[model samples]
Structures are given as structure tokens and as C-alpha cells.
Target: MSDLAILKRRHALLGEKAPLFYEEPVHIVRGEGVWLYGPNDEKYLDGYNNVPTVGHCHPHVVDALAKQAGKLNVHTRYLNEEILNYGERLTATMDDSLSRAFFVCTGSEANELAIRIARCATGGMGIIGSDATYHGNTSTVMELATNRKMGGPKRKKSNVRSVPFPQMYRAPKGMSEGALAQAYAAEIQAAIDDFEKRGIKFAGMLVCPIFANEGLPDVPLGYFELMQQIVHGAGGVIIFDEVQSGFGRTGSMWGYENTGIVPDIVTMGKPMGNGHPLAGVVCRPELGDAFHAESTYFNTFGGNPVSCAVGNAVLDVLEQEQLVEQAAEVSAYLRSGLDLLKNDFDLIGDIRNNGMFFAVELVKNRKKKKASKKKPLRIVNMMKEKGVLISSIGADRNILKIRPPLPFTTDHADIVLEKLTECLIEVEG
Candidate 1:
């Protein structure tokens, strides 16, 4: 069948609301490290996928999956060494206090379970999330996905409070970094105080420590530390949603590592199984123990042997290849190239990056910093025509998201930069 025919069939079944990228969506049939192959055997640089972190169809991970499936594929109810070992490996990477793990299939499930544990352990009902954030699709998690509504009127639920993201690029006028931190921190405190005023117990806060969805906004120093104190003082836990920003995406093992505020609960997915459906919530052992005593929970497919094997293989690849260090090294190189592009292009208003995940903001008038998502939209479609893949982020959708796999090298970045230059020129024209 032709590409358009296939796409029409897909839309017939999936509905119009189902999201697909590009004005002319390419029929991607295969993938390798940081590259995708279209139906006609055309190769496109994959610069917008962090899900296949170690790389697409990695040999080691595929082998592990095949071997485990041939031997056994059973739930965690049985004595499974793979699950146990994978859990140990996962928590070993977290803070010492966060030593327990509960497996789930998606980041949504992980986050939902994390909040439940928080409410169970703390006996509180109020939760905090950023104004532009996406936790998951589940009803409870969707309430926290303020980005889904694109900054519209938020849910009237008092249990969930949305805070303005500490975005330095969009910080209020006349505010230095220090004052910005103070102002953002003060907003959080006020939210907590409002929770108290309404007689709502402070359950905890759910935040993307790296703020990946909000175009990976530059974090304000001292803000996390101050918020940690306030939340804990009010007897609440901190839940870090590391679905996109964790797993070495931000040049660190964990997003909270540089923030100086260790999270009480950490929910991870996407890159956890390196393209497989594996994810979970990690928390302090005591918190899990307390929750377990009151309630019993189990997922049939979660933490099974096959998923565990895939997770283990992903860790193995990350460790053996030192992809974390590679990401850091290559990101510096890529950063320099992006900076050069910014120098050459007047449309680039700002560049925010951490590790391989970077956001390039396009503006109509750089002097006024006037954002125009239409420019990025044009650039996105143009880059597609040039065999490069990237997308936009944020409510305005003006920030181009450049997140290739971990194996992406400086050579690949060069192609992206060159093609992006051509796209920008066309947009300028």
C-alpha cells in the first residue's frame, strides 16, 4: 500500500485526535542508532526520540529479550531472579534512602502509584505540579498534566495546585537569578499555605525535576532546596517524575542529582527498558512497607521476567558503553554547534539544553523576543523534507526539541545543524 493509503487507514482506526508528526508524515519502517528508515529506504536522522535511549534495536537488548522470552515470561508472583536483580540495579542508581521499587508498565502507572503511596503514607490529599507539565494520561495523572490543556483554565480541584515553572528565559522583568529563585520559591510556599488555609492536608509535590516538558527550562538554584524544606516541614513527600529527563538524558543519572534535593519518590519510564514496556516507582523502603501493610497491589505484566531481562540489558548497555559520559561529552560539542547556529541565525531567541535534550526557541523579532510557533512549524516540516527529524515543545510550541538517542555523535549533530540551517533559511525566505 502507498504511504498515504496506510496513513488514511491508520486515521480511520485511531481517530483524528491521535497525534502524528510532520505535515507529510513519513512511513518509518525500521530504526538503527539515531537513524530511522522510511518506506522507500530513505534515511532520516532521528533527533527527537529519547525513548530508544541506548539506541533503536540495540543488539544486546534484543538478544536479552529473545533469550528471556524463550526461557520464561511470567509475572512477579513467581520467584523471579531477573525482576529482583533489575530492581536492585534500579534502586542502586537512586539515592540510598529510595531503596524500594514497584514495577509498572508505563510512566503513568508509576506516577499514579507514587502519589497513592504518598497519600497513604502521609495521610494528605493535596499535591503540587508545575503549570506546564505532563505527568501521564490516566485520570489522576492527567490532572497534573497542565501542559495537556495548553495553559487553559486548570482543573478546579483544590487537591492539585499548579505553580509557574521557574523558567529563566521567561522570568519576570528586573529579576536576577537569585530574585527569580526567591519569587518562584515564594509562589510554591504560597501554594502550600493555601492548601493549609483550605484545610487540605499537604500530600506532596509532583514535578519534573528537569522540567523537560516545559522546554527543559533552566532550573533556578536554591529553589528546589527551599521547596524541599517547606514540603518536608509540612510532612509531605517529593515525587520526581523522571520519565523523560532521567536515565542520563540530562547528563546525569538522575535529574534531582544537581538540585541538592533528593526526592522521596521517583517515577521512571520511557528509556527504562530502552523501547520496551517497562517502568516503575522507586521510593523509600519504609514508605513502600507502610503502604503495603494497608493495601495490596500487583500488575500482571509489570516486572515480569522478559521485561526484567530487557531492563537489565538496558542497564548493561548504559554501563558498558558509558553512554552517560558520552552524552555529556557529545552534548558539549553539540552545544557549541547550536551556539554557532544561534550566532548565525537571528530567529533563535534562546537555547536551553541539558545533555542531549535541548530546546531551541524561534522568535519573529529577537529584539522583542517575540515567539512565533509558526516558524518552528515551518522549520519542522522543512527539516523533514531534508531527512532530519525534530519537533516543537512548550505551550507556544516555539521551542524546537532536539533529543536524539544516546549513541548520537557529533557527526550526526553536524548533519542536523546543516539541515536545520537550510530549514531556517527557507523559513526566513
Candidate 2:
């Protein structure tokens, strides 16, 4: 079928919810390593997909899945070494206190369970999330998707309070980093007070350490640590949503690893099974145990043998290839190239990132540092036209999100850099 016909059928079947990227969406037929291919085998560099963390259709991962599915594909009901071993391996990456694992099929399920655990443990009804964060699609989790309610008229969740993320890039005229940190934490403290006053107990804060959708804003130093302190002080747990930044994206095993605060619970997905439908939550043993004892929570396909095998393979590839280190090295190279572009093009406002999780905030005026509101979509569409793939995020939709596969190299970074520059030039001119 033709592309337009497929699109029409898609809209007819999937309705307006069908999201296809690019002005002229490419019919992606295949992917390998860090490149996507069209029906005619036209290559497009992938700089916007982190789901294929180890790279698309990695043979190592594919083999693990195929082997496990053939031998044993049972659910967690029966005795299974694969799921047990995978859980053990996964928890080993976290702190000793947070050594328990609860497997679920998607990030939303993990988050939903995590919040349930938080509320049960603390006997609280209030949740705190960053102003522009997207947690998940489930009803409870979507209540925490504050990104949708920030700039528009929408029904507010009284129990869920939103706090401003510490964005140092567009800080008030002379605000120092320390001041920025204090101000954001203070907002949380005030919210906690308000919750107490209204007789609503504070369960916890759902945080994405990188603050990805808040434009991957350069979070102020010591801000997260301070927020952790306040949340625990208020008798609430800190749940880090690592769905987008986990599994070797941020040059580490977890995005929260470098943030200095040890999260009480870490909700993860997207890259867990490396394109497979797999996700889960890691949390404190006591919290998980308490929730398990009180509630009858069972997912039929949560920790199945096949998913565990795939999960194990993804982790193995991450370690054997040293993708974390690769992410670190290539991220630096990519940043350096972007820094050079920032020098060449005044449209580049700021480059905010650590490791492969990057955001290039475009600006129309260099002096004013205003967001080039409509340019990112146009630039990404043009980049798609030029045989490269990328996307945007944040409230204004002006910040370019450039997270590629973990196996991306310096060579790939150069290509993205060149294409990004050319796209910016074309868009600006």
C-alpha cells in the first residue's frame, strides 16, 4: 500500500491518537545498529530512539529471545530460573537498601505499582511531580503527567502537586545555582505543608532526575539531594522515574546514580528488553514486602521467562560492549561537535545533556535567549527530509531531544552534528 493510503487507514483505525513523526513521515521498514531503513532501503540515522538501547535488532538480544521462547516461555507462576536470575541481576545494580525487584510489563504498570506501594507504606494520598514531566498513560500515573496541565486549561489533580524544575539555562536574571536549588526545594516544602494542612498525607515525589521533558534542563547542583531530604523529612518516599533515562543512557547504569540522592524506588522501562514489551520497578525490600503482604497484586505476564531472557541479554550486551562507556565517550564527542555548532550558528541557544540524553534548545534571538517556538518541529522535519531522524520535547516544543542508541559512535555524532547544523541553517534562512 502507498504511504498516504496507509496513513488514511491508520487514522481510520487508530483515530487522532496515531502519532506519526515528520512532516512527510518515512515508511521505516527496518532498523539495525543505529540506522533505520525505508521500504526502498533508504538509510536514516537514528538520533531520537532510546528504546533500542543496544541498537536496533541486535543479534545478541534476538538470539536470547528466540532461544528462551523455544525452551521455556512460562509465566512467574511456575519455578523459573531465568526470571529469578534476571531479577537478582537487575537488583544488583541498585543500592543495597533498594535491593528488591517487582516485575511489570510496562513502565506505566511499574509506576502504578510503585505509587501504590508508596501510598500503602506511608498511608498518604498526595503525590508530587515536576511541572513538565510525563510519567505514564495509566489513570493514576497520568495524574502525575503534569506536563499536560502546565500551560493549558486542564482538570487539576488536587492530590498531585507540581513543582518547578530547577532550570539554570533561563534562570531569573541574576539567580545563582545555589539559589535556584533552594527555590525549587522550597516549593516542595510549601506543597508538603499545604498537603498536611488539608489533611492529605504526602506519599512521595515522582521525579525524573534528568528532568527530560522540562527540556532536560540543567538541574542545579545539590537540588535533588535537598529535595530527597525534604521528602523523607516529610515522611514520603522518593520515586525516580527512570523510564526514559535508565539502562545506560546517562553514561551510568541508572540516571539517578550520578544525582547523589539514593531513590527509595526506581521505575524503569523502554530499554529494559531492548524493543520488547518489558518494564519493572526496583524498590526498598521493606516497602515491596509490605505491599505484597497487604495487596493481591499479580500480573500474568510480568516476569515471564522470555522477557527475563531478553532483559538479561540487554544487560549483557550493555556490559560486554561497554555501552555505558560508549555512551559517555560518544556523548562528549557529540557535545563537542554541538558546541562547535553553537559557535557557528547563533540559533543554538544551549546544549543541555549528560551522556547520550541531550537537548539542543533553539533560539531566535541570541541576546534575549528566547525559544524559537516553532522552529524545532520544522528543523526536525527538514532533518527527516535530509535522511536523519530526531525529535523535540519541552513545553514550547523548541528543545531538540537527541538520544540515539547506546552503540552510537563519534562518527554517527558527526553526521547528526552536520545534519543538525544544516537543518538549523535552512530553517533560519
lDDT leader: 1
lDDT of 1 by residue, 66-184 (tens): 99999999888978688889899889998899999999999999999999999999999899899888888777888877664533335555488889988788776788888888889
> What 10-residue stretch in candidate 1 is worst by lDDT?
148-157
Backbone N/Cα/C clashes per model: 0, 0
User: RMSD in angstroms, candidate 1?
Assistant: 1.4
Worst 10 residues of 2 by lDDT: 148-157
| Candidate 2 residue lDDT tens string, 1-429 | 889998999889999567788777789899999999998889999998999999999999999999999998877888769988999999888888888888889988988999999998888989988878788778888876655443322424477888887788888888888988999899999989988888799999998878887789888898988998999999999999999889989999999988998999999999999989999989998998878878967888888999999999999999999999999899999988888888888888999897898899999898899889888888888888888888999888989989999999999988898888888788768
What would the TM-scores of all predictions be?
A: 0.97, 0.97
Error of 2 at 396 (Å): 0.7
Q: Cα RMSD to native, each candidate? A: 1.4, 1.6
Off by over 4 Å in 2: 149-157
